[model samples]
Target: MANGQEWWRGSVTYQIYPRSFMDADGDGIGDLKGIAQRLDHVASLGVDAIWLSPVFPSPMADMGYDVSDYTDIDPTFGTLEDFDALVDKAHALGLKVIIDQVLSHASDQHPYFTESRQSRDNPKADWFVWADPKPDGTPPNNWLAIFGGSSWEWDARRRQYYFHNFLREQPDWNFHNPEVQDYLLDCVRFWLDRGVDGFRLDTVNFYVHDQLLRDNAANPLPWAQEAVRPFEMQYTLFSKNRPENIAFLERLRALLDEYEGRTMVGEVGDSHHSIDLMGEYTSGSNRLHMAYSFELLGPDFSPKHFRSRIEAFFKGAPDGWPCWAFSNHDVPRHVGRWLEHAGDQEALAKQAAALLLSFEGSICIYQGEELGQVDTVLSFEELTDPEGINFWPEKTGRDGCRTPMIWEANAPNGGFSIANKTWLPVKPPQQARAVSAQGENSVLAFYRAMLALRRAEPDLRLGNTGFVDFPEPVLGFQRGDSLMCIYNLSPEPVTVDLPSRITPVLEQAAEVGDGSLSLGPNGFVIGRLA
Candidate 1:
C-alpha cells in the first residue's frame, strides 16, 4: 500500500450485525454497549476496522434497514450516549467504526414519509417516489419487490402508488428530487460529523431509478434456478443501476472527503451489471473508495467460478477496488454451502479464511467467521427471516446465517443474551465452536495467524494478482514477488507440479509440499517464490 493510502483498501473489516452481535440490555437484541464490551475481541483478530449494521430507529420490518430516523439511536439498541461511548472505546482500541447507511429509503413511520403521504401538496410530497395508478388501477410499471410481490404499494391517503423495492413499509426515496438528495446528504453529514469513520452504503445501485418509470424487461434466462428472491426474474435495468446514480455517489464521496481518511464502500446488488457498476463507482479518487457484490456470496464454490469472478473484476475495472467476502447476513455460510467438497468442517473453515485473505482486495469477515461457525439449523417454527419463510424447502432464508454469535461453548444461549428465548436459535454445533472454545488452537486462531501474516507480508497485503496456469479443480495465483497461493477444490488427493525454485514459507499443514505437492481434499498452500 502507498503511504497516506486510504485505510479501507487491503484492510480487514469485521462486520457486526448489531442485532445478533451481543445483547447488553437482556432484550434479546444486541446494542452499542455490548459491541463496546466486545471491541477487544474483534481487535484481537488483527482486523483494521468494524462495519456495524444499522442501529438507527426502525420498525424492524426489514430489521433496521427500514429506518424511521436517520440520526437517533434506536431505543431497542441503546441511546446516543451508548453510541458515543462505543466510538470512543473503538477508537481507543485503534479500530475504525464504519456504519451501514441505508440512504435509498426510510420507514413508512418516518416523519418524512408520513408527511409525504399525508397530501399531494405538502412540503415533503416529492420526498418519496409516488406515482399515479394506470387506467386499470395497476402499478405504473412491472417493477417487482425484492422481498416478494409488487414493488409499488397502494396508499389510501395519497390515492397514489408508492415505489418500494423492498417491504411495503420501506418506501424508496425519490433521488431525482434535488431537495430529497440534499436532505439525504445532510443525514450523511450528521453521522460523519459525529465521528463515523466511514459508511457501507446499502443498495448503492438502487439509489436511483428510471425517471420515466419504464417496466423492467424479462430476464433472458427465466428457466435458470435462481436464489430466494423473486425479483431476479427481471433484468432490473429500469428499476435499478440508473445512470443518475453516479453523480449522487460523487456527491457522497465529496462529503466524506471533507473528513480526512474517511471512506465509503457501496453494496452493488445487480447481477449482470454489478462489476461494471462497481468499476464506475470506484474508478476515480472522487468516487466511492470500494464496492462489493453478491457474486461470490452465491452457491458456486468451484475453482473455475471463483477464478472467473475475480479475473472478470480485474479485467473490467483496472482502477476500481473490490471487497470480497464468503458469508454475510444475506447469504448462507460458505462452510455449509461447500461442505460436500470440504470433507472436514474445521479444515474447510481454515481453507475458506485462507482463500479470502489471499485475494488481492480488501476483505470482510462476518461475525462468526473467525470461529469457523457454520449456519445454524433452524426449524420452520423458529425461523424469523421473511425470505426464508417464503422459500422454505429449496432455499431456507438467511436466518441460518444471522443467528447470534456464540461466545461461550457451554453457557446458555452461548452467552449472547440473558433472555430465555433468542429471536434466532443458536444451535449446538455452532455453540461448540464458540469464541471461548476456539480461542486457542482453533479456527479462530488460524484466522488470526493468517491475518497477521497478511499484515506482515507486503506482497500479500498490497500486491497485484496474476493467475498461474493450473489444471481443473486447482486454483493458483501469485501475489507480487514472494507469496504464491494454491487451492485444491476437490474431494480427492491430487499431485501438482510446483515452480522448481519455489520454497514453502507458510503452509496450512505440515506435509504441504516436498518438491511435488500432494493436496488433500479442499487443501491449500502458501509459499514464497524463489
Candidate 2:
C-alpha cells in the first residue's frame, strides 16, 4: 500500500441511506442533490468518508439493494452527472466516497436477468443461477431466504427455479460464470474511473453458491429458542458462504488495486461463520481491505460480548482489519436496541460512540446516531419495510431505523422534506431529537468531540486493542500503549481500579481520581497511559 493508500484503515465513515438522507426536490424521497447539499454536515463530523447505500438504478424491490443497472444512478436518485458531481463535492470536502455494490443479486428487471430468464439457450441464459426443478417439481433445495421462505423461486419464463437469498424479485448472479464476473468487474471499473474511493459490498458472503446444489443441513446449536425467520433453522452451508467466493473477491481486489488509494469494505452477513469468514475474506494482501459483521450491531451489550467479538476477529484473522458500527439502515438504532441493558438513552448514545471510536479498527457512524436518534415507533399501516411488513407484530421491519432523517425539529417532516408525505413518516419522538434541537451537552456534540479526538490521537486510530480484565457491565481495553479506555455499560454506577498508570483524557465522559475510577450510568473514561 502506498502512503495514505490505507486511508480507510482506522477511518470513520458516515453511512448515507440516500432515500432517507435528505430530499432536495420536495418529492418525498431523498436524492443525490439532497446528499450533495448536505455534505457540509457530514464533513463537520470529522468523518473521513461517506458510504452511500445503493444509489444505482433500481426497481427498489429491496429498497435499492437490488440494482437494475450497474453503471448509472437511479432516476429517483439522480443521473450519472449528478453522481459525478456528488463525488467531486465529497472529495472537495476532504471526504472519500464509498458506494454500495450489491454484487450478490440484481433486480429481476435488470436487462441481464431479463435476457437470461427468457430462455435456457439465450446468450445470457447462464448469467444468473438457474436450475431445473427436482423430479417432483418441488424446487431445487431446502435453502431459505432471509425474507422467510425457500431461496428458490419458480420462473415461469424459463420453466425453472432461480435462487435468491433475499426477495424473489432479486435474483442471484452466477459468479460461477466467468462472463458474469467480468461484467461485474467492468461495472466496478466504471465507478473507479468516475473516482469513487471504495465500495461497501452488500451481503459479501453470498456471492457464490455451492456448485453441487446440495441441501443445507440443520442448524447445529440450539438458538435457545424459536427463530422468527424460518431461514435461521438451517445452516445454509450450500446456499451461501461458499469457498469459491474467495477467488471472486481476489479478482475484485485485483481490479481495485488498479487504482491508487482505493479500498473496499465488505458486509459479512453470516451468523455462525461471520468471524471465520471475515478473517478469510480480508486475511491476505489480495482481498478486501476491511470487513464488518453484525456482532456489535445487535441487542447484546456487555463487556463479554464486546471483548469476544473483537478478540475473536483478531485471533481468527490477525492480518485482517474490521470496520465496526452500532447502527445502520438494516437494524434498529443502538439507542433503542441496547436500552434494555444500558438505560439512559442519551448517555448510552454518547457512551456507544466513545466505545466504538476508541476501538482499534475503522468505524462507521450511521446518519442519525450522532443525534441520539431512536427507532421510530410506527403503526402497522405506516410501515414500509418489507421485512417489518412480512413479520409484522413479531418483527417490525427496518423502517423504524430507515425513517427519513430528522434535521430541523420544527420543520415539516423534521426538515427531511416539504412534501405532505415522505416515504416513511418522521414521528414526533424522532423529530424531537433532531439536529436543531440539540445542545452543547447533547449526544450530537459529544460525537463531534469524540470523532475529532480519534482523528487527533494516533493511538485511538492505528493502535492495536488489548482487552483489560474487568468485571461484567464494565468494558475495559488498552489501545496500543498510548491509551486506556473503560466504560460502564449499564445504568448503575460502578467503581473499579484504574488498571494502574492510566490518567483521564481531557474529554473524559466522567470523573476519575484517587486511583479509583467512578463510572456513572453509561459512563466511560478514555485515559492516556502514563
Candidate 3:
C-alpha cells in the first residue's frame, strides 16, 4: 500500500451500472445526466472513487459490452455534453471516475470489424482474430465461450471463423497486431483526454491467445462440474492467459502513467491460476495498478474460506495490490445469497461491510449495498439477462441483482425512472431500504460510519493484517499497530477471550458485549489494541 507505487491501495470504489443506476429521461434506461445528478449521493458515501459501467455506443447485444463506437456516448445513455458534465461534476465532488473499458472485443457493427469482415484482404482485415475453419468445417481450435458453446463463429462473408469469447456478435480484437494495439491505445487516449481517472479492464486476461490456436487441456479437478454452461468443464490455459498479454498490459499502463494519479484494475476471471495471474498483472510498476479475482464472489461464505482467499493473495504476490468485492453485476447479491446462514439480514449486511473494509486491500462497494439491498426475485418470463435466459431454471440470471436502484420508497419505479414500466421490477422490500427512508442510523448510515472509520483509522485502511487464533466460525484478525477485528460467521453466539493488549472501540451490534467480547450470530466487533 505504498503511496508512490499504487494510488488505488486501500481505496473504496462505488460501482454504478449506468443502465440500472438512475434514469433521467422517461426511457426506462439510466443515462449520464442521471448519474451526474446523483454525484452528491455517491460522494456522500465516503468512497474514494466511482467506477461506471459501459456508456459507450453499443449494439446492446451484451448490454454495452459489444461496443460499436469507442469514442461516442450511446444516445440512449446521453449526448457527449452530458458525459463531459458528469466528468466535471464527479471531479468537483472529489470523486474520481473510472470507466469500464471492454478492450477484449468490439461489436460486429464497429467500423474495424465491419471492414475486417467485408473481405479477406481489406484494409482492416487483420484487425480482428480471424481464422480458417478445419477440414471438417469445425472451429480451428477447442476454445469455449464464457456465455456458452464454442468461442469461434463461422463468418460466411469472410469464409472463415472469428474468435468471440463472450457473445457471438462481439468479435475479439487482434491485440498481437501493432496497428490494432495503436488503435486501442488511441481509444484510451480519447477517454484520458476527457478527464477520466482510470479504467476497469474487462476480461483482462483474454486480450491475447496462443497464436497457433492450440486446444485447451481438460480440467483435472474432480469438483469441476458443468452447471450453468459447458465451458466451465475445461481448463482455459491455451484460450487465454497467454504470455504475450503482460507486455500489452505494460504498454497500456505506460499510457495511463502519463496521466498523474491515474489507476487501472483488471478483471481476472480464470478459476485456475487466478491469484497467480493477478500477481503477474499487478506485481510490477509497469502493469495494472490493481486486479480483482472471483474468489470472494464465489459461493463460499465461511470464515475459513475468507481467510484462505485473503492469505493466498497476500502470499502469492507480496507486492501486488488486490481489490475485493463480494457482489457485482454478475453474481447474486451477497445479502440474499448469504441470508440463510448470516442470520438477521440487516446485521449481516453491516458485518459484511465491516469485513470488506477491514481487509488489507482496496474495496469495491456495489450500488445498493449501502442500503443492504438483496437480490430481487425474478420469474423466468421477467428475466432479461442473456446468460440467465440461456441457463433457465438451473441458474437464475444476473437480472436479480441488476435491478434498478431505489431512491424513494413510494415513488414510481422506485424513483429510478419516470417510465411506467422498468426493465426489471423493483421490489417493495428493496424500496423499503431507499436512501430517503434510511437518512441516518440506517444500514446506509452504518455504511457511511464504517467508511468514515476506515478513512479515519489509519490501521484499518493500509495496515498489514494477521489472523488471531480463534475457534471455528469465529474469524478474528488484527490490523497493523491497532484495530482487532472479529466476526461471528455462525448461527449462534460465540465467546472468545480478548487479547489483553486490545480494548473494544466499536461494536457493530449492541448484543455483543463491550471489552471482553461475546458475539451473537452475524455479530462483529472492531477493537483497538492497547
Candidate 4:
C-alpha cells in the first residue's frame, strides 16, 4: 500500500452515520465509543478508511449538519477523549479516519451566531450573512431554503434578514468576512492536529455566496416545475457557486498541506452545475483532493447516463480526481432507490458493490450496504428527517435508510442498541439481512472479494478509463489497458462479445461460454485482456 501521503488516491471509504451505526452505554443513539467498538467490522470489509458523519457539538436540528461548536465532540455522542480514542482504535486497525466537516453554515444557537445577531454592531456582527429587507418588507430576494419556503429569516435583535440555505436554525456564514474565514480554517486545523486523515466537506459549493445579494434566476426550462424544493425552481447562480469559492479552497488546501497525509473531498450539490463545479474545484492541486456530486445518486441508471457523467468529468479536468458513491446518509439506499431495475435485491446489491468498486476513483460505501439492507418502511409518525416531515406522505424522507444497522438478526433492535427504542427503527426486513445471518457467499462476502480484487490490481484502482460501446442496458468500460468492466443495468440477461485476448478476472457471478460473455440479470463482470 502507498504511504499515508497518497493512500487516498483511490481508496475505499466506508461512511458510518454515528447515530444509527451502534450505541454504547445502552443509549438509543450511537456515539464515538460505539464507533470505536465497531472498527473491527469496518476493517473487515477491506475498506481503507471510515468516513464518519458529523459528530461535533450540535442541537441535531438538521441531524448534526448544523454544528454549534466545531472543536468539541457533541455531548450526545461523547467527550473529545472518546473521539480521540476512536481515532486511535481506527488507526490501530489500519483504517484511516475521515470526518464530515460542515463549514458553509452553523447552528443559530452557536455562540458566534448568538453574538453576531446582537444588535449587529459587535465585533462578530458580520460573522453570518445578514441583509436588510426590501422596501416592501419582503425577503432580500427570491432565494428559498432547501428544506422549503424562504431562505431568509427575519431576526428581531439585528432587525435584518439572515440567509439560511437549509433550515432557519442553520444560518449561512458570510465568507466575505475575513475573520469568518480565519475562524473556519482554525476549526479545521483543530481536527487535523488530532490525527484525522481527511474531511468530507458538506455543501462545499455554498461556502461563498454572491456578495451582491442578487436574486436567483428561475429554473430555465423543463426542470422548472419538476423540481422538488422551491429552492430548485431557481438556477441559484447568485446564491451559490460563486467565483470567489476557489480562493477559499486554495486557503483550505494550504492548511491541509501543512499536515503530512491529510485530504479533503467536497460535496458539490448544484442540480445543474455540479459536474462543472466538481471539475473546477478539483482541477488544480491547490484545491480539494476530490469532489463528489449527486450525478450517480439520481434514478438514472442507464448506460448513457453513467458513461456521459464519467466521460464529461475526465474530459473537463484530466488532472483532477473524483470520489463516487451510490448511496450515503442523505439519500435513499441504492437497493431501494433502484429496486425497479433490480430483479433480486441480493443480486442487485452484489452487482452494485462490484460495479462501484470497479470504477476508477475513490469509492464510498454507506454502512449496511454490504448486508443488502433495503430502506425500512416507516409511517409518518416514525419519521424524524425534517425534509421528510416537511414533504410528508409525498416523500418518506431519509429516515427509512437512516435506521439502526442490524448486526444480529434475532437480537433485540438488531443488536445496534440495547435500549428499548432506537433513534430510528430496525425493521424485520433489515434484520433478516443482519451480518450474523450472512453466509460465505453473501453480499458482504462479495464486497470483501471486490475490494480485495481492487487492492490487488493497481490498474482498477488508479487507471485511466475508456468507455466501451455496448448497448443500452449493458454498460461497458475499460480500465487502463487490460481490465474491462461490464454491467447489465437492468434485470435481463445480456450477451456481448469478449475482446480478442481476454481472460475473465472477477467472474464468480458471470458466465462465459464460446466467444461471448453472458451476464445474468443485474450481473457484472471484470476481465483482463492479454
Candidate 5:
C-alpha cells in the first residue's frame, strides 16, 4: 500500500458479535467485559484490527441494532468505563478497535423519537421521517419494512405515519434535518473522544430517503429462489440508497479525518446495485475507507461467481477499495450456505480461509469462522430472531449462525458463559470444534497459517489481480505478476499445468509433482512467479 494510506488497506479485521462472543457477568449474554477478556485470542490470530457489532444501549427490539442510545453503552453490556478498558487493552495488544455505527435509524423508545411523536409542534418533531396519510388514511407510499409489513407505522398521538425500514420500533432518522445530522455527528464524536480507531457504518446506504415519498417499483424479476417478505417484490429505490447519502457520507468522512489514522467501512445491503454503490462509496478519498457487499456472503460459491464479483467491482471503479467476508452476523454461516459444494466440512473450511486471505483487499473473519462452525439447527421454540420467526420452517432465520462462540470442548455453555443457559443454546457439534480442541494442523491453526501467509506476502494483500482462463471449479488468478493463486472448489481432485516461471509455495493444502500441480478436493495453492 502507499505509505500515507491508512492501516485499513489490505488489513484483516476479526468481527466479534458481543451477544455471542463471551459472557463475563454470567448473565448468559455476552458483554463488554467478556470482549475485553478475550482480546488475547483475537491478537493470536495475527489480525490487524477487530470490528465489533453494535453494543450501544437498546431495548433489544432488534438485538443491539435498534439502538435507543448512541452516546453510551447499554447497562446489560457494561458501562462506558468498561468500553474504555477494552480499547486500552486492544491497543496494548496492537489491535485496532472498529465499532459499529448504526446511523441510519434509532429505536422508537429513543428520547428523540419519543419527543418527536409527542406532538407535531415538538422541538424534535422533524428528527425522524414522518409523513401524512392519504385522503383515505392509507400510507403515503408503498414502501415495505425489511422485517415485514408496511414501512410506515401509524402514530396515534401525531395521527400520522412514521417510516421504519426495519422493525416498527426502529424509526429511520431524518438526514434532511441539519439538526439531526449535527446530533448524530456529536454522537460519533463521543466515541472518537473515547479513542476508537474506526467505525463500521451499519446500513450505510440507508441514511437518506427520497424527499418526494415516491413508491418503489416492482423488481424486474425475483432474484432469490423464494421471496419470504413483501419488501423483496419492490426495487426499494425510494426507501433507501438515495443520492443525498453521498453528502452525508462526506460529512462523516470529514469527522473521521479529524482523528489521525482512523478508518471507516460501510455496509451496503442493496442486492442489485451493491457493487456499484460500494464503488461509489469508497472510490473517492472523501468517502468510506472501504465498503463490503453481500456478494461473498450469499449462496453463490462458483469460480465464475467469485471472479465476476471481483472483476466487476474493479471494472466499475478501479480506484475503489472493497472489504470481503464469507460469513457475518446477518447471514447463514458459509459452511452451511455452501454445504452442497463441500467434499468435507473441514477441507472446505481450510480452502475458504486460504481463498479469502489471498483476495486483494481488506478481509473480515467472523468469530466462529476459524473453527469451521456450521449453522446450528434450532426448533421454532428456540428461535429468537424475528426475521426467522416471520418466515419459520421454510426459511431458518439467522439464529443458527448467531449462537454463542465455542471456546472449550467439554465446558458447559462451551465456555461462552457460566450461566445455566445462553442467549442461544450451544449444541454439542459446535462444542466439538472449540478453540481448545485445535492443534497445529487443525482448522483454527490453518486460519492462523493463512493469515500469517497473507502478512508475509504483500502481493496477496494489495496486489492487482487478473484471472487466468480456466473452467468451473478451478479458479486461477495472477496477483501483481508474482503470486499465482489457484483454488479447486470441487470435491474431485484436479490437475492443472504449471506455468514455467511459477514455483509452488508448497502450502499444506496444495501439492506439486513433476511439471503438474495436483489439487486435492477443496485444495488451494499460492505460487510465487520466478
Candidate 6:
C-alpha cells in the first residue's frame, strides 16, 4: 500500500468471458486474438482493469473450471505467445489484466491427478484427497459435489474415493500437504513473471477441507423449495470452508507482495456464511485485497436487502473491503431478474448501474451490461451449464447470461461469429440490444458518462458511505459529508423531502427543487447537498 500501487482501491474492473467476447478468426469461438482485437472497446468503457475468466488448458467438464494444465492457455483459447500479445495490447490501451486461478481443484485428466489415482504408492498419492470407504462399501461421508451427487468418486486402483467439491471430474486438492501449496504458489509466480496486473481467485473459500472425512450437517434453517440444488440442503461445514484457508491466503498474499501493484479479489462460494467469510478473508489487508459474494447478484431487489447486506459486511470487518456487481456470467442478467421492480428496461439498467458504480469500494461490470443487455431465453436443449441441466425447470442455469456479446444488431450470430452456429446461440433478443444500434442517449453512452464522472469527482469514488435512516422503497446514503445519493427502488413514484436543498448531478426520472424531490420508478438522484 505504501508503494502507491493501490489503484485497485475504489476502481472498476470489467469481467471478460473470452469465449463469449469475440471471435477474430470466425471459428465460432473466441480466442486470445479475438480478445486482443476487442481491447480497444474495453478501454473505451473507462474500466481500470479487465478480468479474464479461466483460459487454462481444460477438459471443459466444468467449462474451463476443470483445469488440466495451469501453466498454458487452452488451445480453444490460444497459445502462450497469443496471450502475451493480448496482454501487450491491453497494456497499450491503459487497462490492467487480471486472470483467474482455480487452485482448489484440477480436472481428473491432469497429469498429477492421473498419477495420484494410478496406485496407492504413486509419487503423487497424497497430493489429492484420498479416503478409504467403510466396510459397507459406500462413500466416506455425506459430502456432496456441487454439480449434483456424492462428493466422493471411487478409484479401483487405490481402493479409495477422492473428494470433489464441484464436478466429480474436478478433484479437490490436498491443501494440508505442504508440497501442494508450494507447487500452486510456484504456478502463481509463473504468471507474475508474465506481467499480469492482478488475479481474480476462483472458489477461494474452498481452498481447504476438514480432512477428517466428517459428514456435512443438514441446514438448520428451513429453506423449503427455494433451494436451487441438493447441495443447498446441507451446511457444508465439514466438506469445505475450513479454517486452514486463512494461512494459505496469507502465503499467497506474501507471494503477491513481491510483485509491485499486484492485487487479488477472491470469490467466496458459501451459501450461509459467505458474507462472514468475505469479511474474514479480506480483513487486516494480510489476505485478499477485496472479495465478493452472491449477495448483490441474486434476485432480491429492495432498499432493505441491499442495505442490510452492505451494512453487515462493514460492521463485521471494519478494515476489510468488498467488490460489488449486479450481473455476471454466472447469474441471470439483473434486467430480467428484477424485471418486476422495473417499469422501463432502459430505466432500470441505468439506475442499477448507477447504484453499483456509486458503492464504497471496487466494483465490477459484467460484459454487455453497459448496453443494457437482457438475458437470452434458451430451450433446455440450448442449455450447456451442468447445473441448469441437472435442475432443468427450477433453475434454467447460467447459459442465459453467458451468451456472446452483440456488437451488431443485424449481423449473423449477433456479429459474434460468421459461422452458422456458435458455441452458444446468440438469439434475437440479445441482437436487438446490440452496441451498433445504440445512440448517444443509449445506456452505453450513460455508462461512459457515469464512469467519467466517477473519475472526475473524488467524493463519488473514494468517499465514506453512510446510509440514511429511511424506510423501505426508498434508499438514501451520504457519500462523505456533501454528496447525497438517493434511490426509489419501486415501480411507483415516491416523493420525499431532502435533508437539505440540493443540486441534481446525475438523475434518471428524478427531480429536485426547493427541499422536495420526486423519484419515478427506478429513479435515482446523485446530488450535492446544500
Worst 10 residues of 1 by lDDT: 505-514
Instruction: State the weakest 10-residue window (summed lDDT) of model 6.
Output: 1-10
Alpha-carbon runs more than 4 Å astray in model 1: 1-5, 222-228, 510-515
lDDT of each candidate versus the true structure: 0.87, 0.90, 0.88, 0.89, 0.90, 0.89
Over 18-52, each residue of candidate 6 has an lDDT whose tens digit, in order, gives 99999987888888898887788889989898999
Note the residue pairs that clash in candidate 3. Answer: 501-530
Model 4 clashing-pair count: 0
Error of 3 at 430 (Å): 1.7
TM-score of 5: 0.98
TM-scores of the models, in the order given = 0.97, 0.98, 0.97, 0.98, 0.98, 0.98
lDDT of 5 by residue, 1-530 (tens): 22244789999999999999989999999999999888899999999999989999999889989999999999989999999999999999989999999999999989989999999999999999999999999999999999889999999999999999999999999999999999999999999999998999999999999999999998767564257777888898888999999999999999999889899999998857999999999987999999977889988888999999899998987888999999999999998887788789988888889888888789999999999999888999998999999888777788999999999899999999999888899999899999999988889998988888888788888889989877778998998768998898888888888764567773545777776678888888888886
Query: RMSD in Å for candidate 6, one decimal?
Result: 1.4
**Judged by lDDT relative to the true structure, which candidate is superior, 3 or 6?**
6
Stretches of candidate 3 off by over 4 Å are 1-6, 510-515
**How well does candidate 1 score on lDDT at residue 372?**
82
What ranges in model 4 sit over 4 Å off? none
True lDDT of residue 18, candidate 6: 90
The lDDT, on a scale of 0 to 1, for candidate 1 is 0.87
List the candidate 2 regions with Cα displacement exceeding 4 Å.
1-3, 506-509
Q: Pairs clashing in candidate 5?
A: none
Residues 1-530, candidate 4: write the lDDT tens digits: 44668899999999999999989978799989998887899899899999999999999999999999999999989999999999999999999999999999999989999999997789899899999999998998888999999999999888899999999999999999999999999999999999999999999999888888888888886877776677779999998999999999999999999999889999998878888999999997899998976889978778898888888888988888889999998888888888889878888898889888888778889999999988899999999999999987777689988999889989999999999988888889899999999999899998889899998889889888988888779988899877888889988888888654467887645787667788888877788876
Tens-place lDDT digits, model 1, residues 235-272: 89999999899999998888888888898889987767
Report per-prediction Cα RMSD to one decimal: 1.6, 1.4, 1.7, 1.1, 1.4, 1.4
